[model samples]
Each structure stands twice: as structure tokens, then as C-alpha cells.
Target: MQRPAYGQSPPLHHPVPQHVSTVPQLRSPPPPIPQQQHQQQAHGYDGSPYQQQPMGAGPSHNVFGQYGNFMNDPAAQLASQFSQTAFKQGTQYLEQNVNRYVNVSALKHYFNVTNSYVINKLFLVIFPWRHKPWSRKQTVGPNGQEGWYLPPRDDINSPDMYIPVMSLVTYILLSTLIAGLRGQFQPELLGYTASKALGVVVLELVGLKLGCYFLSISNESQLLDLVAYSGYKFVGVIGTISLAEIVNKGKGTGGWFGWSVFLYMFLANSLFLMRSLKYVLLPDNHGDARGPMQTGDTRAKRNQRTQFLFIYSYVVQFAFMWFLSRP
Candidate 1:
């Protein structure tokens, strides 16, 4: 092509045109697509065939559906079932083992005492000279059987482990306090004292069991009942030691004053035991209706049991109390 002169209005040159195709050309970039239609077609490049969906549809809609599918899976169902079975079996095993050695209901009864009952029982234990009836109150059961002892909350004569447990703990604490006051307190001394006190109680219990066995005593009283009765001596021992200490002005539990106080407590405790145990050792005598007539051998055996009871109440109590009261 020849260049046009600058002065002359550039000669209009006809531009060479390329071959036109049948497809129509876009004007102004095909007028920009509507925003809604553009959004609808936005997923075109995801390599998936476009399908019309509801306006608000999104990934969030499938969340619960996926979860439901997972829950319906056999593996998940089986795992859930296994966990429930394991929990139930573990619960049953624990309950069985717990029920084996421990009498949960009986323990509840022993502790089911009222404050009034406790106070009255304490008074009776301390002073039995005035109180008349020593036998425990009996009730008729649903099965029409008599001789069902009333709960401690209802009867003062009902044996309860509550007082015994409290008194034993108190005794140990008081002993620790006494040791502290006497400048004999040691950390290990607490354990030693508790062990010694418990050991003495065990020995007394064993001795009583042996006596019961040899004397052919009825097994109406449970083992815990015997423990409760034997533990009464601790109350007297506590009184004796405490009074002796006070009398000696925290100096020591020695001298005639201490001995006199101890002797009084020992005698009081012995009397309490004698009265309390009378009902247990001689149940046939306490009932409203007299039992079957006894043969000579039975009478002789009863007399022997009576003698054994006296010796145990006085002699054994005296010996144990004297040993325990030592500062």
C-alpha cells in the first residue's frame, strides 16, 4: 500500500475483509448474562452435567441424610448394641458382688435410728438400775410370724450399730487427744492405737462367739448385734478415762481417784451388759408364753449358761475394761 501525503486528507483506503463465517458475531460481548442465570450456570466448569436445582439447595441439605445413612449401617448398629450389653452386664456384676458379702438392707436398719432413740438408749446403757423391761420389742411380720424385732427407731432395746460405731470413733479420737495432752502424740501412734483397740474388740468378739458355741446359745442375735453389745463397754471406758484425766488435771490416769472412777464405770458397764444380755441369753424366759418344759439335762445346761453369762458379764468385762482404760 502507498503512504498518503500528510497535507492531503488521508486518502480513504478500503480495508481488506477476511472471509465471514455463518456464526453471528456478538455485539457488546453478548450483553452480559443476567445475574440469576449466571449463578445458575456457575457450576458448568466442574466437569459434571448441569442439572436444575431448587434456589436454596446446598451441601448443608445432605448433612442429616449422611448421618442417617451412617446410623443405619450394620457395623454402627452392632457397636451400639455391644456397648449397651457391656454396660448392663457390668452393672449386674457389680450389683451381685456388692450384694454377696454386704447386707445392705440390714445395714440400713441398723443405722435407721432417731436422735430420741439414741439419747434414750444411751441413758439406758449408762443407768439400767431404773429401767425395767430389757427385752426388745417384737412385731408380727406379714407372714404372721412373731419375734420380729422392732427397728431401733421404734424400740430402745433394739440393738443398733450406730452408737457402737460412733462411740468407737470417739474413743479413738479421745485417745489421740489424751496422747497429745500427755506429750505422747505421734503420727503413727494414731494407727497403733486404732489397731490395738480394734484388736481387743476382735478378741472379745471371738471369746463371746466361743462361749455362745459351747453354751449352745440360740443364734437369734446376729454377729453385728453381738458386736454392738460388746462395743458398749467402750462408752464406760471413755467415761472412766475421761473422768480420770479430768480428776488428775490432765497429769495422768493414775492414783486412787482414777482407780475409783474406773471401778465405778466397770461395775456400771457390767450391770448394763448383764441386763442387756439377759434377754439374748435367756430368750425363753422373756416371752409372754412359756416354752416347752425342759428336761433335767436341759435345766442343767440352762444353769451352766447362766453361770457362763455371769462370769462373762462381770469378769470378762472387768478384765477388758481395766486393760482398755490404761492411759
Candidate 2:
């Protein structure tokens, strides 16, 4: 090493530094500060008190959370209650309207029956020859009326709407099935078939009403009874059609065997009606206590009514069956 002079020019030499290692040294990171200490440090830096808030302590941060809060709101709860009350009131109004025209309690009686009664009634409708005493058994009703007929559960001869309703529905479904099998089915065909069946029922009802009016035998309660008896023909019609289908195997409704089955069913149904309607048409012969005492003119009128009953049981049934069975 050489030193430089203060005032005079002189040669100078710089000192050499020491060598440093090229490899890096490893060191652990410092431990994290506590939450309180961190918050205090932030407060000191900002000159204000810093609050450490818990998770979700502020306003809702997600859509689901906001929706939950809204549902708990009092306004939303009140709206829900109002909708429920409106629905109940609407249901009550509809029920009141329906009960105005229809006798629901009386209708329920015709549907009161058991499996055994259904089976036995079906047998009687199909094969009515051996059955005796077509008269219905009378029973004391809840109101103590004496003329009320026994429920179908107790008497197989009693008329019931159950079989008729079930048979009618089955007939419509079967008709649709047969039409589909025969390749004559259409979407509109269902509506057409239903309309036609309902129309036939309406026409028959109208004719019966007209006949009763002319014969001076009009009755409101008996209307349901007449409808039930008239609907029994559907059972035979169903049997005849089903047999015809099975025999022909979806081919058609025309054959010697089909015709034979149809003729037999028609005759059986005619006989069933003849026996069943005797009580309704000729109340005098059946010993109905509700009927008035017979007079000479009433007796003569009953003779004419007897002829009408025969015509209805045979002629009307045959015509209707033939029409229904047509392909």
C-alpha cells in the first residue's frame, strides 16, 4: 500500500477487499403475529381503533344468504299467509256451489256396496233366469222411513250405481282398445266415442221421462232408480262385446259365433229388465205400500203400462244393443 501526499503529487495504491462465499444461507421465517397485535399495529399506523370482525358478521356476501334473510322478513311471511287463506276460501266456495244442485248424501247410498254384492249382481245381470223374488227388501232408514230399499250389501236385487259407473268407464276404455286393435283409432275418436255414449244416455233418459209423464208416473227419487236399472244393460253389452272380440280375435264384430253370443246376451238382458222393472212400473202388483189404492181407471192404465214395459224391455234393449255393437 502507498499513501498520497496532501499538497504534493504522489502515487497512491487502493486496498483489496476480502472474498465472499457464493452459496446462499437458509433461514426460518418469523412466527405470525397474534390477531389482536396485528389489529393494534394497524390502529397505530392509521391513528384509529381497528375492529377485528368475525366471519359473516357484516351484510350477506352470497345470493343464497341474502335470499334466506328475505324469506325471514315479516312482509314475505305475511304474503305467504294471505295466499294460503285465499286458497282455502276458494275451495269452500266451490264446494258450496257443487252441493247446491246435487244431493251428495243420497248419491253416496247408491254407491254403498261390497265385493260380494258386485259379483252376485254381475251374475244375475248376465244369467237372470234362476233368480227369484225380484222385489227389493225394504228397510227402516236413519230417519225411520219404511219404504227405503235395503242397501246392495244386504240384497243382491237392490239397484246400485257402482256397477253402472264402473261398467260405463270400462265400456269406454274397452271401446278405445278395440278401436286401436282394429286400426280405426284416432286421437279425436276418444272424444267422439265419449260424446256418442253420453248422447245415447241422454236420449234414453229423455225418452223414459217422456214415457213416465204420459203414464202419470213421474217421480224425482225414482229417476235415479230408473237410471241405475237402465245402466244394467251395459253389463250384458260388455259381455257380448268382449266375447265377440275374444272369439274373433280383434278381426271384427261379425260372425256366426258373435251373432249368437249377442242374441243370447240381448235375450238375457231383456229378461233381466222385465223382472227388474216390474216393481218400478207395476207398483200395484209388487205390493208397494207407498202407492195409492188402485181404481178401475188406474187398473186399465196399468194394463197399457204393462204393454209399454214389454216393449221397452225387448224392443228398446235390442235396438240399443245393436247400435252399440256396430263396428
| Top candidate (lDDT) | 2
How does each model score on TM-score? 0.69, 0.73
Off-target runs (Cα >4 Å) in candidate 2 are 1-88, 289-297
lDDT of each: 0.79, 0.80
lDDT tens digits by residue: candidate 2, 1-327: 777678888757787655547556789975566865775444443234464544553343456698899999999999999999999999989878988987777788799999999999999998899999888888787898777777788998888999988988887888988999888888987887777767777787788778877777634466778888878878877887898899899766689988998899899999998988777776763457554324544667988879888998999989988887776
Candidate 1 Cα misplacement greater than 4 A, ranges: 1-95, 285-297
Model 1 C-alpha RMSD vs. true structure (Å) is 11.2
TM-score of 1: 0.69
Query: Which digits, one per residue and each the tens of the lDDT, describe model 1 over residues 164-226?
Result: 888888889999999998788999988877897898899988988888777766554456678
Angstrom error at residue 83, model 1? 9.6
Q: Assess candidate 2 and give its TM-score to the true structure.
A: 0.73
Worst 10 residues of 2 by lDDT: 40-49
